[model samples]
Target: MLDLLNDLLWGKVLIGLLIAVGIGFTLGSRFVQFRYFGRMFRILGASQAFKRDKHGHLSSFQALLLSVAGRVGGGNIAGVAVAITLGGPGAIFWMWLVGLMGMATSYLECTLAQAYKTAQPDGTYRGGPAYYIARGLGQRWKWLAALYSVLLLVTFGFGFTALQSYAVATSFDDAFGIPVVFTGLGMAVIVGLIIFGGIKRIARVAEVLVPVMAVGYLLIAVVVLGMNLPRIPEVFLLIVNSAFGLEPAIGGSIGAAIMMGVKRGLFSNEAGLGSAPNVAAVAYVPHPANQGIVQAFSVFLDTLVICSATAFIILLSGAYDPASGADIGGVALTQVSLADHVGEWGRSFVSVALLLFGFSTILYNYYLGENSLNFFSESNVTLFNLFRIAVVVLCAWGAMTDLGTVFAFADVTMGFLALANLIALLMLFKPGLRIMRDFDEQIRAGIRHPVFDAKKFADLDIDPAAWEIEPEDIERLKRYGAPPPSASQPVK
Candidate 1:
């Protein structure tokens, strides 16, 4: 029943909707993701992108890091291996194409998120598909918002936390012989500390650790790939040929390759699934599209950079077997491939990497669920707090319990969440494009620091507080060329 539902939701329904919406956004925005690609690096390089610009909150770049933290987890390693293993090397091409198209989907969803975000009591922000569906669509459509929130709560808050903790526990147990129970408790403690500190701490930690871990992992992949430089062409041919059914050894047909590629790629980067926008909306940027551009770059980093690293490491090492690919998945394939290429130490590295990757992802997932709960009732501390406690408990349980059921539950819920989110994205696409155009016109006029004026968008049913500039912060930004003190946190 679970498998049937998943096939129906993801394979039969979402594949077309996902790609269509992505292509639509890409065209609607006139390929803003590409035209603004270089500006992504410029914004990232300047502190304006990372420092607060709106009410004191996470910066645009920090929000990107937060979203990337969610995107970069163990899936980059194990998931890529599974895609190539089952889908054939051809699946890599599909993943790349989805990553490209999904960039626009991510942009449109996040732009709406930023435009509709609510100012939280603690000077932080919270929003996502739910917030946008309500504010962007209308008050009457709030039920759809509530529906998306519920699905997000179930999938990320409960289901994914367990899955992540399970990965961490199993990896640590395999690597250091730490008992799953012990690892679970320790993991829970670390998570409790950070989440208790709220979004500020989560963003701080992501800014520091995410970049370090991602760069280190990629450096290692580069070295391994460098060693196999001669076979690079062969592996490339396999991935490309296998995708189109030109290579019979990799799979049975082109459809299988496309399905596996799109499925895993969509799942891995979460381009249009509505998850990243939860973090995206928290960023303090001059224009809503600023964060959208940053989030689109994140898709590139996740699928193109991190996921591709895993694929190359596996294929380049000659460790992946298409004949037995069905059995190759998750941590096992990653561990085996790295161990074969770089010595047994590579296996231990992967284990440690998975532990960090899964744990960071769990942190981000907690925030997503917490944000969902906030949408229901910001005044109800008891409920969202209770959900957080539940998340911590489930994280530990996921580490020790049989996860077959949990994984299945996660899949079904995620499929539904994507369905809800994609619908909202399509409906809200035009307004989102307008916001993007506003930002683009500013850039075209050579405005280095393009500030958004909410008055212009008064026609939209938006929370004015989101775009209102605090009076004191204006002079401070003019004087120092950075945002006010509230925007800067104590660096981790």
Candidate 2:
């Protein structure tokens, strides 16, 4: 049943919808993701990017790291390997294409999220597809918003977290002979500790750990690639040829490549899946597009950089044979490939890297659930506490469950979640474009840093408090050469 459902969703319905929506968003935004690619890094490094007057609000950079933490997980490592195993080396080509198109989709959805974000009573912001659908589209769409929230809670809150925990436990078990149960229990305890500390603590941990783990993994992949420099061209040719069915290797059908690549690509970067926007909306950016641009870059980092690293490691090592029918796949394939390159230590390194990647993702996934719960009821302490406990328990339970079952379940839920968000994105397309245009107009007018003025968008249902500028802050912006607060711009 799971396989049948997955085939229907990934092979038929989602593949077309995802590509169409991605192309639509890209065209609608005039390819904003690529046009502002360089600006992404600049926005992250800008001094204003770190400003947060509220105690609980995340800086843009922190939010980027948090979203990246959620993105660069087992999907980059194990999921990449799965794509190769089931869809052939050609599947990677599809993954690359999806990542590129996803950049635009990510920008649109994330910008809308920031625009519709609500100012919570606790001095923080909360929003996502649910918030945008409800608030941006008005009272008629609240049910759709609620549905998206429920899908989010089930997909990221429970499903993805459990799957991540299982990945970590399996890797540890394979590497150190640790009991899966023991590893699961330990992870559950740690997850409970950090999640209880709230979003700030999660942000702090992501800020420190995401960069370290991602860089470390990439460094090792670089070493493997360097060792196989001569075969570099061969690997590229193989992926391209296999993707088109010109090279008839195992699992090399063009259809399989497209299906697997897109499935795994969405799984890895989550650009259009409504997941990252949860974190994206939490950032304190001068303009919604600033964070949107920052997040578009994350898709590139996850799929083009990190995931490609894992793929190259496996392909270049000559450890993975397309014709081999061996049961070794997923993290095992990655571990074996690295071990073949470096030695037994390579295997241990992958286990450790996966542990860190999966752990950070669990933290990120938990926050998404928490954010969704807040959407339903912000002040329900008992309910929130119970949800936290459920998260911890699910983390442990995930470790002990069958890996295939967990992954299958996650994929189904993720498909539905993405479907909801994509529908909302299509409906709210013009508003998103309007927000992007506001940022673009400011930039063209020579504003060094664009500030969102809620009054300018009074026609939209944005939360005024969320975008309100303090008098002191306005003065501070003027000192930095930002334009003064002015009357509403003519709505296009």
Candidate 3:
């Protein structure tokens, strides 16, 4: 039944929808992802990106790191191997395509998330597909919002985190002979410590650890690729040939390549899957598009940079042969390939890297669940604590269980989650376009940094408290004296 559902959802429906939506967003926004590609790095270096305040809200950079934590996980390593095993080396090319197109899709969804975000009592923010679907699309469509929240809770909160736990436990068991049960229990305990401290704690941890683990893993890939520099051109040619069926290899058909690449690509970067926007909404940015652009870069980092690293390591080591019939795959395939290059130490490094990746992802996934749960009830402390306990138990259970069923379940839920978000995005398309236009107009008008004016969007359902202009912003507007209807005054 699970296999049949996956076949129906992924094989037929989502592959086309994912590509079409990505292209639509890219064209509709005039390729905002690329237009502001260089600007993204500039925004990251801005002082606002790291600023914290009396309110415990996340800075723009912290939000980016948190979302990156969610994107770079077991999928970058183990999931890439699975794509190669089932879809051949050509799958890497399709993954690259998805990552590129996904940049636009991520930008649109996350920008909408920021536009519709609400201020919470604890001085934090809350928004995502759930908030936007209900508020942006009107109250009559709140059922759709509830549905999105439920799917997010299931997909990220339980299913994906459980899978992360399973990956880490299995890696330790393979590398150090550690029992899966012991690894599972230890991970669950650590998770409990951070989650109980709340979103602030999660943000702090992700900001510190995400960059370290991602850089460390990429450095290892660099060394391995450098050692085999002569084969770099050959590997690139093989990927392109296999992608177009110019080369004969296992699972080398164009259809299989497109399907597996897209599936695993979405799993890795989560561009249109609606997960990243949950954290994206938490950021404090002058313009909603600022955070959106930051998130689009994250998809690039996850699939293009990190996932490609894993692909090169596996393909270059010759541990994964399309011509040969061998059963090696997943994290083990990656471990074997690395070990081939650097001996047994490489295997242990992968085990440790996966532990950090999976651990950070668990932190990210748990926050998504908590945010979704808040949609139904904000003050239900009892229910919140119980949900946390349930997640901890699921983490431990997933580590010890066979993952066939769990993985299937996660794929199905993820498909539905993306389906819901894409529909909401399409419905709210014009408003999203207007938001982007607002930012563009500001930049074109000689404002070096765009600041959102809620009065300009009075027709929308945005919370004024979330976009209240700061006194510093008022001063900055005074300095720019070029436009009528100053930012401080209401637009007539």
Candidate 4:
């Protein structure tokens, strides 16, 4: 049943849905991805919303790390390899194309998450398709929200996390002859330590680790590209040529290339999958669109940066035989490719990379699972605790299993999750657009630093605390020598 459903959803329906939405959103949002691409960096470097408050919730930068932790993971490596193997090297062109348009889709979904967010008594926030569907669309849509939560729980919470662990285990297995079960147990312990510390720990770890791994991986890719300097132009040509069936070396149909690329790109960057917005909503940004732009940049980082690095590494090493690689897609292929180019040490380097990438992704998945259960009731402590255990157990179990089956199951559930989110996004898009307009108008008015006013949106379901700024809190922060209000986190 799952295979059949996955075949239909991934091969046919979701492809068009994803593409159409990406294009529509790209145009509708006035090229938000490109227009504000530079601003993403400005926010990253200058934004002071990264301070740790008394609560466990993360700041904007930490939230970006959390989201990136999920976005730039095993999928960026193994998943891209799978796409290239099945779809041909031309597949990367299609991935780039999807990524180009996905920025707008990411902005829309994330902005909606911020606008419709609800604050909990614990001074934390929770929002996503579930929250927005219920609050923005009305209580009549509560069932749809719950359905989304269930799908997300299955998709990110369990299935996808398992795949990350599986990739880690396989990489280690290929590298050191480490047994899968042992790797699984080790992974479970590491995951339990961080996840038990909750979102704060995850964010803290991500803020530090994500940048290091991403930059290190890119640096290695640049080094690899230098080693194959003459092949650089040829690599670009092959990608474009294969995408359009102009390259006969691929020996595959253009349709296969398009489908595989879109699938892997969607899974890797998670632009419209409705997963990132759950974390995006948790961020304490001055404007909802601020987080939207940050996450839009994240899509670029995931597909254009990390995944591209993996593709280049594999292609440059000349390790991927289209015919043979199709049967052996995933981290092992990457490990071999790096080894072929760099040396015997390449295998060990990739294993360590996989461990960090996959472990961070597991943290992302666990966070999403807790939010999913909380969607039903934040006070459901039993469900939350049990789900945490399930995540740890499944993370271990997944490492011991074949990942081909794991990826397929995740695709099916994610298909449904995206469908729910896309529908809600279209229906509730105006509020997000309104928020974007507010952001744009502020920029135009020379506000240099935009501060959101919750009272201006009294009609929406936004939690007032999210926009509220207490004088004493300001004094406390100032006394600690906290920086000025960032354009991301403005003072009231």
Candidate 5:
């Protein structure tokens, strides 16, 4: 069953759909991501409404941190190595291309998440692909919502939960001579403590750890790239030629390049996967667009900055070769590449990095599963907790299984969920555009602010308007902030 699933999903059908959705979003949104690039960075770096919230759950930076925690995980290390192994160096180029367009898709989906966000009874916010599917497309298609919930629970909770643990276990075994099973047990206990405390604790951990780790890894990559600076031009040519199957740097063929690039690129950045939006909706800020832009910038950070860093390090280290055995994938592959540059200690460092990256992703994925459960009932906390514990057990179990099968299951399930999410994005494009226009109008007018405030959404009927954003109040998000809802189209 798993093999069949891999055959069906890892082929052209899934790749085409993923690429098509990215293109559709880019075209549909009038390339808002590119047009507003400077504005997005300005909003992320500013500091003002750090504490304000109408019915707040997390600060803008906290939200960014949570989303980054998920994106910059095991995938960056293991996934990229795996991508290059199968897809060749050219795959790097394809990954970059998808990320470029994927920013728009992420913006649209996350904006819709904010647009239809539901206010929690505990004065918090909850929204994701499921919420948008139900509300944006109307409540009649409850099955769509239900299906999304189920897929998320399985893909994230069961499939990905275990995948993360397995990465941690493998890394520990390789670096410290520790048993994989005990490592899994340790991981479960840590996860249990943090998750039991809920999103706030998770957000706190992510906020502190994510930035430090991301910069640390990037610095390492810089060192590797600097060492091999002279060969940079040749590497660039190889990447381009391989992407087109002309250079054959890694057995140049269009099929190999496209497949490897698309697969790894999608896995690394997850631009169309619909996971980041879950975190994006919880930000305490003004306008769905505010969070949407933040989410898009994340894709840039993930693929353009972070993933690019990984590719440069691996390629420049001279450790990966298509004709040789050095083309290792995933965590092990990255360890090999890093070790080549930094020596034996580099393997230990890579292992530690993988542990942090994979653990943070598991934290975020669990939070997403928690939100999906909310669609059923707001107070099913105990059942969700149990489910998460079970996930921990499976994570341990996954450590002893075949990695190829483990990844295959995760890949197929994740692809299916992304398909559903992209469909939702396609259907909600019109409404998302209207919200963007509405937000821009409000920002241009002096009446609106940029932080979370229900007043900004009072005259608006969009479900996400359930809470309003105040422009003057949001920290790290002031430049593009808007004030109260404008009079242009007051809710009837």
Candidate 6:
């Protein structure tokens, strides 16, 4: 059954759709992901508003951390390793390309998320692909929203939750001989404690842990790369040459590289996966474009930075051979590569990284499922909790079972959800473009403190005073440079 589902989900139809959607977003936005690539970092570095702009929600940084918590997972390690094993080094190029294009997809989805966000009675916000798809795409097409909710609840909460648990449990057991059941139970307890506290607690935990884990891994990768410095240029040449079916470096055809890269890269950053947008919606910022900008940077961090770090370390270590050996797959391959450089301790460290990375992803995935459940029934909080707990148990089972089946099942479900989300995003691409234009206008006008509140629902009763833009903010905006349409433009 799982094999059949895999065949159907990953068949040419879905693969074509995924690629087409990515290109469509890139073309529709005129490759805004690239045009604004530098601006993304500039805005993040220079914006006092992004730093201090909190409206009773997570700061832009914290929201970004929350999004990163999911993207920077075992996929960077085990999944990337698997892509190389299955698709070869050339796959790395495709992954990078997909990630680049994915930034725009992330921006578009996040913009829509903010555009359709609904405030909760408890003074918080909730919105996601479903909300944007329904509201932005129009009420009549709400079935797309409903379908996404159901797919995520099962795929993420139930399916991928299990996969994450398995990664944690298996890594520990492989590294330290700890019982799998013990690991699973302990993880369940930790996750339950956090899920019960809601998004605030999740954000608090992620803000600290994501940075630590990402920096620590990058540091380790740098050390490994330093040790293999002489091989760096050759390894990169191989990745590029193989991407175009050049015969010398990679023995395999270029098609393998493209397929593997697309599959693994899309899985890595999850730009169009519809997962990150759920987290993006929770942010309390003035403009959806603010969070959208942050999310674009996240795709860069996930694939360009984190995933690349892992790929380079593995490739440069001289651990893999494309010609002779069978493909070394999953966390085990990463362990072997790291161990070759840093010894047995390296393996253990990868295990710990896997646990932290996978655990964070599980928590974020459950939160997405909870929101998906919320869309189905506002009063089903208890049921949502119950379903979430069940995910922990599934995670346990995932660790002790045949992961091929589990992974294949997850792909089927996630691919379906991603397709549904991509459709919604494409349908609402115009709204995202409009928001970007509005933000650009505000920036050019020297409107630093532009009012960000735009209500989608007529029933939503917002107080005018709460959303008023201040003149002082306009002065502050001047510091960032007059936005494109504003007369404060630097006199050329």
- State the lDDT of candidate 2 residue by residue for 141-182, as single tens digits: 899889888988988898888888887898899899999999
User: Whose TM-score is higher: candidate 4's or candidate 5's?
Assistant: 4
lDDT of 4 at 417: 93
Give Cα distance to truth, residue 432, candidate 3, Å: 0.9
lDDT for each residue of candidate 5 in 70-100, tens digit (9 for 90 to 100): 8888778777776777777888888889888
- The residue ranges of model 4 lying beyond 4 angstroms of the native Cα positions read 54-57, 321-328, 402-407, 470-492
On residues 327-379, what C-alpha lDDT tens digit does candidate 3 reach at each position?
78888899999998989899999999999999999999999999899999985
Model 1: pairs clashing at backbone N, Cα or C within 3 Å: 89-239, 90-243
Q: For model 5, what is the C-alpha lDDT against the true structure?
A: 0.75
Worst 10 residues of 3 by lDDT: 483-492
Q: Compared with the true structure, what per-residue lDDT tens digits does model 1 show for residues 229-337?
A: 9999998888888887788767436887898899889999998899999999988766687788899999999999899998888887756776754565667888888
Error of 4 at 313 (Å): 1.2
Write the residue-wise lDDT of candidate 4 on 1-492 in tens digits.
889998888778877887788888787778878888888876665445436566555677887888898888878877898888888888899899888888889989998888888876665678887888988888788899999999998888988888888878877887899999999999898888888877767778888889888888889889999999999898889889999999785735798888888888887898888999999988866568888999998898899888989999988876777755345567778878998999979879888888888888889989998899888777677777788788889878998888786787788888899889888887876787788888888778665546677777778776677665544455544443433454444354
* TM-score to native of every candidate shown: 0.93, 0.95, 0.95, 0.92, 0.90, 0.89
lDDT of each: 0.83, 0.87, 0.87, 0.82, 0.75, 0.77
Score residue 339 of candidate 3 by CA lDDT. 94
lDDT-better candidate, 2 vs 6:
2
- Give the clashing residue pairs of candidate 2, or none: none
lDDT of 3 at 11: 81
Q: What TM-score, to 2 decimals, does candidate 4 have?
A: 0.92
How well does candidate 2 match the true structure in TM-score terms? 0.95
Once fitted onto the true fold, the runs of candidate 3 whose alpha carbons sit more than 4 angstroms away are: 47-50, 472-492
Query: Ten-residue segment with the worst summed lDDT in candidate 5?
Result: 483-492
* Segments in model 1 whose C-alpha atoms lie over 4 Å from true places: 48-55, 323-327, 470-492
Residue 344, model 4: Cα distance from true site in angstroms: 1.8
